[model samples]
Target: MIKQIDKSNNLPSKISTISSIRMIFSYALLKKKEFILMLLFMGLGITFMMISPQISRRVINILENNDSNTSVNDILLPIGLGVLISLVGAIVLGIGRYFSAIVGTEAQYNIRKSVYNAINRQTFSFFNKAETGDLVARATSDIEMTTPVFNQGITLGFQSIIMMIGVVVGISITFPSISWIILLAVGLFLLAISFCAKRMQIAYVKSRKTFGNLTTVFRENIIGAQVVRIFNSQEKEIKKFRKENADFKDYTIEAIKWSTILRYSGWIMLAVMSSFVLIIGGWQAYVAYQNQDLSFDLGRFIAMLMYISMLGMPINQVNNVVMNFVQANAAMIRVKEVLDAMPEIMEDTNAISAENIRGDVEFRNVNFGYTSTLVLKNINLKVEAGTTIALLGTTGSGKSTLISLLPRFYDVVNGELLIDGVNIKKYKIEELRKQIAVCSQNIFLFNISIADNIRYGRPDASMNEVIQAA
Candidate 1:
């Protein structure tokens, strides 16, 4: 599971656009109540933000137009109102984030559960192809990568857009002519971000591939630790570990490098944009003062500066989300592959349940192979109820392979296998497997009492039966 962290650092590689991330998040956060709560709080916060500039301008104007006729209560009243509004905004923002986290946690839980359940249902053949460590990575690390997408992506993504739009609206309503420069700067910044986002996606994919390879190595070393010790190959294993570790480090550094570039680039863009605003704002302020026109109020100019200043946080947040999505894309792809898989074995139409069984089994003229080479050829066998048949074969002579075939571990390539005269494929897999009891040379033991391990064969078997099996 620790291996997922290495892969997680490579998350941003998969997402192509912010919209893609948003859509993915929406699907993940399926619960309506959680979604509504998150949105409600989010709306409150952004609404407060949009109105904040106007309130600040109001306060400034009150202070500027001081007169004996106007009581001190007039200024104090607006100041108090602004402060109260800000307080409510802060509270709403806090609540919104808290609920967003809850939604994300629940959403990730469902995703992880589904991934684990799907993997568990897969046949032994599936494990033969998929690494145990990779499964762990998907369930743990991959599921975790979706958390931010569920939480921040929806709430923060929307809030950023609202804030940007709200600021633009304020500027347009107040000073129509100067609003063009602000809009233009925002558009240019978005274009640059989009270009960098493309490169981030590419880097993110490479990082995920590297992480998968790294996870494979980690899993192999752990599972085969005893084998390495017995063979006196500790040095070899260590060297291999070092190589994988180095590769993981390199990929992680590459991922972080791109995120860093995006983050800093956004900051620099905002800085440049701010400089432009200052130059233009200062010019406008100067012109209004020289012309003795009340069009450009000092109060409104100061408020505009504050609004643009506040835009910095949302801009940075947007950039951060883009980078996070890049790293998470690998997780999404891995998870999607599992979700989209078509099971090799599926129940036949019109399948019926049997109420009784005598445990008679037959394999007639069955030919089978695993992957490339043939393992069973022209095999014919029958086992009646209560029959004790001894299977004797040389190593790799298909004793284990033949036993495996009985449970349909690997289906026969040709011919028929029947249990109680019905074709094995026609019977439900679980029903067929339940009738057989297998005791191999290698017995699997869970982390439980000896009695429990025996009971695993027959989950509802009596204590006496379990003891007898052991």
Candidate 2:
């Protein structure tokens, strides 16, 4: 059986939702100019959209009056202006979307780069407990999910809030009595939002975790294909994979169910508010007409209805934005876990850098364990320069562990490991590693030229040197 390392000990402290969101915003700061430009364009688009309804109201009022003094230009001018504003708004919104895409791509790249570097920095013990497939999922699927949170979730969410505010203000100014109706509808919408958001968050997090587990199952099966074939365990592996796959599907379905309900509920609420506004506004308009009050005419009533519809669009979008935020929050948590991990081994500021080391190694009273059980105990060993030695042991023996200590793949818990008469920890990790190498029992070769493989340790090596090493 393969020895299992305690993963809990290796994992970093869990990051809270607020902290994860803060980190995402900090990452966005890397492309602050692009993000700001996108926001400005979104604001411009919303401003134009808010102005369109007023133009429509004016057109209706002019046509309703049917004044003999009015020319075609009187109606045509506002109609043309409304179209122009809409066209300009579409163009500006498109530009904003383009910038948002660029910003999202750049942010994703930066995050992946940071995560890759952080993973690389971890010691072997960290990888011993980590799954290759889970890491792959985080770097790819997780990053992809997170991009929309920054671009669509935050940016469009801000736009939605601004638009909603503008709609409320416009309605308040145009029809004060019915403005309370809009506010009441919005208040109820918020209550529904809070309840749905909590449930969606739980479902999304579970879904992401299940997906990671499924990826791990697939990855391990592929990597160990030969072993499985030899043992004729294909059926067993398939059964295990199916179980994980089913769990992933179930979790995903649960998440979709909640999100779907939230989305449809938003539409339902908007529809009800729209219908209520229409009924009340129509009654008030009829009353004003009866009283010869021209202010609350059909034109203003129609504009108020249009404004309510406009408000609904953004309110409806809140569901999508919340969904994205929940997924991004989960992905960010996974990513931040890796980034915040403390490497088991760290170089001291005062560590020395050495050159031209003699090949002398020593282990004194070494005691080590991956867990509670010690694998190496009070071991003493020494090898002189230019000497050859062999460590022979059975499958569960500590042979690999013994050799691994020379390069500090792991540090001894209670002893000193030395090279060339100085403690290995005294030497800069990179400088110390440069002078030693181990050809493992299970070798892995890259899909590159033989010359490149030979030069893997020293990319700056000349062709002649690579040939010599080969």
Candidate 3:
């Protein structure tokens, strides 16, 4: 399915965005060496492409000479060489395609791994600020946007450019007098393309971002189905979904509309180019005949025409790659946003491991809040080993807030918290959390068997132990 991500409004800083994309592409290329091989094959195929046209010109000259010195073998030899080059080109192109696909898959795998690692290391605050659906989109959907760009765009896309250059250069060198017609047509097409492409790179990028936002909404609603159902907010959710869907549709339509225009416009340019080249070449051939320098090789013209026509495919591929890069550039911006984020909670590099310690906890004039809203007040408290202190308060009375401080979920606003006569912040977060477990009234089961739930506390627990806990 042609999933459209409409996000033409949220484009990021270009330098950072392009840097992120380059880094990913470079890494993916390294991981999949076959892509490099495919690139080499593409180069070979293009060289063959250039040779086909020249061979045609050669064959034409041979056949047209028809002098007593010329023989069928003369014509046959170049024809055979052209066919051989063509055969080799076809085989190499197939190999290049195979390698490209393999490399693309490998690149996707590496990108997914990098995104997964970044998501895993993200702090709770980051998650709270980011949508679950958005994160999932980055790991799954966004990575998908990059696959084609890496495989075809990074490898064959450049090869196609080289191929186009080879065709142009080959034609210019062989038939310089009439080449200007082709060049003129090319210049006009490029001008039209440049005008069409002016805002498209930016537009497609914006569209992709909108799609990400839409995916985030879809992800959140689906994952939080229970909340939506319990609240009976189906209508509200549907309305929101429809809105996002409409926005995506609009942006996608715009991108496709322009892209289609550019594509057809390019095709028109190619057609005009062909007619121009044919007319000018035909005239030149006539002039050469009058000057006794034109021995027309219809075979060479046919071959040259074929070579010129082949340019169309790579041109299309190049355009597609440009669009792909722009779209991936968008995804890269979103992905980098996560990778570049610095966690709010600080970690201790010099933390020490202390065993055989009592779990003594204390709070001294602690004050806390979420943003500007104070959730806790300045207060003093202490808890020694083996102490049983109950928090008595009505709902929203800061009991949960106070207890949360014990684990350093939120650092005190104006005071200090100590555990084992040491500042809680001094200990590594994981080490500190390991010493305490809060069994909430609402348990989150993993949809696994009962044994698994008990085993969650101790993954290495014995079956007997799990059974006993259950």
Candidate 4:
């Protein structure tokens, strides 16, 4: 039962990045109103932030130009106004973040529900082929990954872009001469970040894949612990688990390495750009001071420096935003894979619902297989109602396969399986299954009372009914 699948072969193939992103965000579209409100609040916050820098310049100008005619109120008023705007900005930003978080959380919740429902609808053959641990990972970790992308990535990323644009416009108006230098720094920063982001994306995908494999290995070991102990193969199982754990560690380290490079490179670029702005702007201010130019002064130079620093903030966020995008993309692909999987058995839309079902069953010229290798050949059988029957065979015989077909666990490839003289396919699958109960050879008693376990199929059954059934 501890079968291994080729994890590499199961890794999601890289699809169009834009298409993946669009599909992921489609879930968020349900909360578009919240998202829009978040943006509006964010815009207000950014507006205040942008205005504060200009107010800072005015306050500096007032202080520097202090004279007999200058009033104390002039400096105090602008400084107070800047502080007030900043406080309001903080409040607005908090509100924006709250709304964004709501949207993100709701989107994640919806996606999780959809995935769970989709998984539940899948036929038994799907579970046979899919790794239980891998499916669990997709439902948990993969869905979690998409949340931050919706919460911080999209909202903060857009805010960063808006802030950058506003800063650029302010800089160009205030210090037209030095604006191109700021643009050049920004362009270089983006180019470097993009290159590193691509590498990080690859690493993140590998890391996610290895994590799924590790989860699968760990789950298999846990479920098969009794088998390992019975065979005294604990050492072998431990070695196998360790190998998968090591692979996961290696992949995680690789992804972290790339992310580190991306972050530090952005920091280095910011440092260089800040130094460039200070030296060049400081030199120009000094020259203007010597020339007694009224156009360029200490206040304007300070404001320009502040604007350059503002540019660095978004540049710094580039790595974080890109990393979130990449991780979300990878997770979305896995989630989509599960959602897109086609169930091997599908109930007909016009399926008949038999009101009263008899226990009689028939198989006519049936053929079945797990894959290409047939496990059951053309055979006909009839089981009369209320008749006691026993199927005895050695291991690998069609006993389990034959009984599994009675419940339509696997549909016949070439013939009909009928129940009460009607093809089982014509019956609603749920209704058909409700009439049959299976007690597998490998009994799995849940951690509950025996009475509760017996009543599991019909919880509404009374205690008397449970006792009678027992």
- Report, for all candidates in order, the number of backbone clashes: 9, 0, 11, 0
Q: Rank the candidates by TM-score, best first.
A: 4, 2, 1, 3
| Runs off by more than 4 Å, candidate 1 | 1-23, 291-295
Q: Candidate 4 — which pairs collide?
A: none
Q: Could you list the CA RMSD of all candidates, in the order they appear?
A: 3.7, 3.5, 3.7, 2.7
How do the predictions measure up, each by TM-score? 0.90, 0.93, 0.89, 0.93
Candidate 1 TM-score, true structure as reference: 0.90
What's the CA RMSD of model 4 in angstroms?
2.7
Candidates 1 and 4 compared: the better one by TM-score is: 4
lDDT of 3 by residue, 43-156 (tens): 888788678777777776665666888877887998899899999998988888778878777877777787788777665557666766666676777778787776677776
lDDT scores of the candidates, listed in order: 0.74, 0.82, 0.74, 0.82
Candidate 2, residues 155-206: lDDT per residue as tens digits?
7887898898999999998888888888988888788777776666666666
**Sliding window of 10 residues with minimal summed lDDT for model 1:** 1-10
User: Residues 171-214, candidate 4, lDDT per residue (tens digit)?
Assistant: 89888887887788778877877787676666666667667777
Model 4 scores what on Cα lDDT? 0.82
Q: Which candidate has the highest TM-score of all?
A: 4
- Model 4 alpha-carbon drift over 4 Å, by segment: 1-16
